[model samples]
Target chain A: MKNLLIFGVGLIGGSIALKVKKDAIFDRVIGVSRHNGRSLDDFVKKGMLDEIAVNVEEAISTANFIIIATPVAQTKNILKKIYPYLNADCLVTDVGSTKSEVMLDAAESLGDKFDQFIGSHPIAGSEKHGPDAADEKLFEGKNIIITPHSQANKVQLDCLWGFWECMGGIVSSMTPSQHDEIFSTVSHLPHLLAFALVNLINKKNSKDQLLEFAASGFRDFSRIAASSPEVWRDISLANKKAIISDLTLYKKEIDVLVEFIDNSQEGNLNDYLSKASSTRSEWAEDKK
Target chain B: MKNLLIFGVGLIGGSIALKVKKDAIFDRVIGVSRHNGRSLDDFVKKGMLDEIAVNVEEAISTANFIIIATPVAQTKNILKKIYPYLNADCLVTDVGSTKSEVMLDAAESLGDKFDQFIGSHPIAGSEKHGPDAADEKLFEGKNIIITPHSQANKVQLDCLWGFWECMGGIVSSMTPSQHDEIFSTVSHLPHLLAFALVNLINKKNSKDQLLEFAASGFRDFSRIAASSPEVWRDISLANKKAIISDLTLYKKEIDVLVEFIDNSQEGNLNDYLSKASSTRSEWAEDKK
Candidate 1:
């Protein structure tokens, strides 16, 4: 009967909390947030968490595992505040999008006081946010990346993996640097593209044109751009290094596409479309 | 009651047929195809078309409105075959992705058979295809662009507008060149980008990395690349000029993004993000 303390009971945390309660995996699931009273009342009424506390010390006092699921910018401060209350046996992990920065922040804030700290990122979520918007199935059939430091003990790392796996995520371990590098290309760059597309059409001359005749293609490409600005801003700032690298690579690829379009002789045009089509087809086949 | 002849009973044409039938505006919805009885049989069985014909002669013998909704490459051939069957007062149009090449094809194929031939592009579709995928709601709240020549009669043009409006689409008019140019940037270029992204990942040394860890962002971004290669190839070839211009602009945007990422000055990062964000927001605001 392991006690679990979930901090910031928002979308990701609340979702996991609901699943844990339903599965009866945790002896006691304590949800801690600034508005813990509301969380407690709601959870009791809805039966999500067994207990809730606003104070960090009280919530984590008997907890064997702690999950920090706050926004990236707020994470460092929260880790610093919670460091003094965490026991030697307690395993602490997080669910942030960016990893390298959070790892560095955790190391700096927790120092020797925190023994078992791991960084985890669940590669799942819609553009929507908040506890109310979260679904228990959000993490099902999704990838959860776990970045454990070299100093992390096997017991704690295994526990963290088990917990994430229980939430219906397929857990894979990577270094914080690797996690940042991979997600920068797959996720961060795409969000940037969506945002940039939005701004491109937002221009004064394009306003009427876009409104009058923008198609489903444009709508689908721009959907994620409508996401929470605050969450994205923090992610961009935190994962700047890997995102920048991936952005450079993506630009190079787009340059190749442009060259084909710019030099559109029949021969060159044939080559361009064929190359793109072949490449896309093979890659698409691999996913299924 | 106006009579309509649809050349292809695939997704776009079939959906249009269903809507036209449901609206009760058209006197007859006739299907023409080389698929013997297969395609037309499905449409008739589903109650989309009033009748099915194996040859162009029987299909357009009485139709005042002829719609060539074949794949881009097949459009010219279909238009030519139907030209001899068309009535003197018939209005010829298409529901293809690319307009310029089709306009040229229509002009060449018809010669002097009719008073006017208009080109149309409905910006609506699903990843799914064939007559089975057709739905009356396919064009609901969608945009339809009509590329009418100066020679197009007011009656024919107005009829074309009313036709799409009846199918629940918001209609906008543009010249052939303008239609090609806009869609090149909005549809063709983004599609090429998706293809290129898929190719880049496929060419990576660690292809399994994508298999084990690729998330929804990568999945959605590359979804369009999964579209039929034949359809896309025709689109790429047909709208070469506009698609080329768009591919170039997209390259330039990507280059700018790369530069900011390479330089990594905190001050310049948000500029890229903001540019995309603003454009997408404006696009989103144009729901109609």
Candidate 2:
């Protein structure tokens, strides 16, 4: 893309900007954010962004591509605000974790402009946040899921796929609904469990002692519990339909396991745990 | 101590044997197992053990310090078999994952020999097992929980503490009940959640799709799910009371969190997540 405009320049946004600039893939990179701050200035100083713009319309006038790199919860409002100003030929896409809701929001706010929207999620990020945490090659050797609805433009979809490929992403395509369902199980549910687990330990009377004696297993298990609460809360609520579905399923499984343990049924418990361990081992083998 | 006899020379037992032998802390080390195997012979060849013994009574006959490194479920039977053979003034101890049950088992089988039993748990071990996986410095810079019951001999207790300290474990004493409770929250509960999480996803119709798209978060969160099913099943059952208590409380927290997400109550969800994130950060700081 010759001209690129990016909104919400945080970890994902900043990384993309830095990477594209390093690869010399874009001729002009325009940055737009809610607030002007040292971070934005640092981005410009680092040559990731050519300039920061205060006017959305002005930024859209010259752009052939736009990426909404904000939380899923903010998708619709931002789409509504920028829809009128978007260039007719420019394609718009997002980097939100949840896809179906963002697609619904795009369809609602953008109307005819919805054809330009492609919902994408790059499964590469650290628990750290902000532009300072952005890595020049964060998207290298990562998986990127592009969720396109029925109305999505074929050319734009392929173009977005190629764009991510240029940044070294292994791109895959699926329906927005399927994307949400899969992620809710693999990504969102794990975060929900970690947050609750950490909170439970903290509220216990033996909190200090528990933390003191916690070993490497505890550290690895709860590392995600230190993730940005704001980002996770937004993702959890915005994707509530998928997450709640997984959570309900998860609750049922946990209840069954608890009953087996309480009754001291060694064979049943072993069968349950063995199934999980074998599956995990199989997956790890595939990963290798 | 001299003439150490270790039963069930797996990872923990083998590691202690290697460390004590390397440090020249013991005059003789004898490994006892229920089966004759290549792994036991490998241990002898590695110099982790001076010999493998089939006669538990003959092995116990000359030992001043004996370490039972078997699973918690096997504690009572092993104690019963060795109690009659243990020499007077010789101190017997264990490396079981659960404390109170093992202590009770030691008491029941040993009878008047109860004072010779000191229950301890070294909070350092990998998921790896067997003689080949043993590390001479496994316990170095690790915490060892020494739980000696009311009837435990004072000299034996002190001697066990010093023994662990000599292997670089910073030893601390706590009631067996406290050790069970603390580990239930930090260790057992997380393992339970991981096993259930993996099983839930595996049983799903889209299991392959979910595993294919799973990310680093899923990998780290479910690493413990790859642990020994039999070992964890034993731990879960042996420490059922503490685990059930934690699981019940954990179920409640998850229910409330699920409710908040379903209703999209940003304030409540944010507050709950914030508490966990902050507590994790605080603990991480303490670790540093």
Which model scores highest in TM-score?
2
Q: Top model by lDDT, which number?
A: 2
In candidate 1, stretches whose alpha carbon ends up further than 4 angstroms from where it belongs are A1-3, A35-62, A113-115, A264-288, B1-3, B19-29, B35-63, B81-87, B259-288
Q: Over 4 Å off in model 2, which ranges?
A: none
Global lDDT of each candidate: 0.75, 0.88
Fraction of native contacts, model 1 = 0.38
Q: What is the lDDT of residue A234 in candidate 2?
A: 87
TM-scores of all predicted structures: 0.86, 0.97
Q: Model 2, B98-211: lDDT tens per residue?
A: 898888888899998888998989988897888778898999999999898887778888899999998889999999999999999999999989999999998899999999
Chain A TM-score of prediction number 1 = 0.92
lDDT of 1 by residue, A128-192 (tens): 66777768888887788999998888998898889888999999999988887777766777777
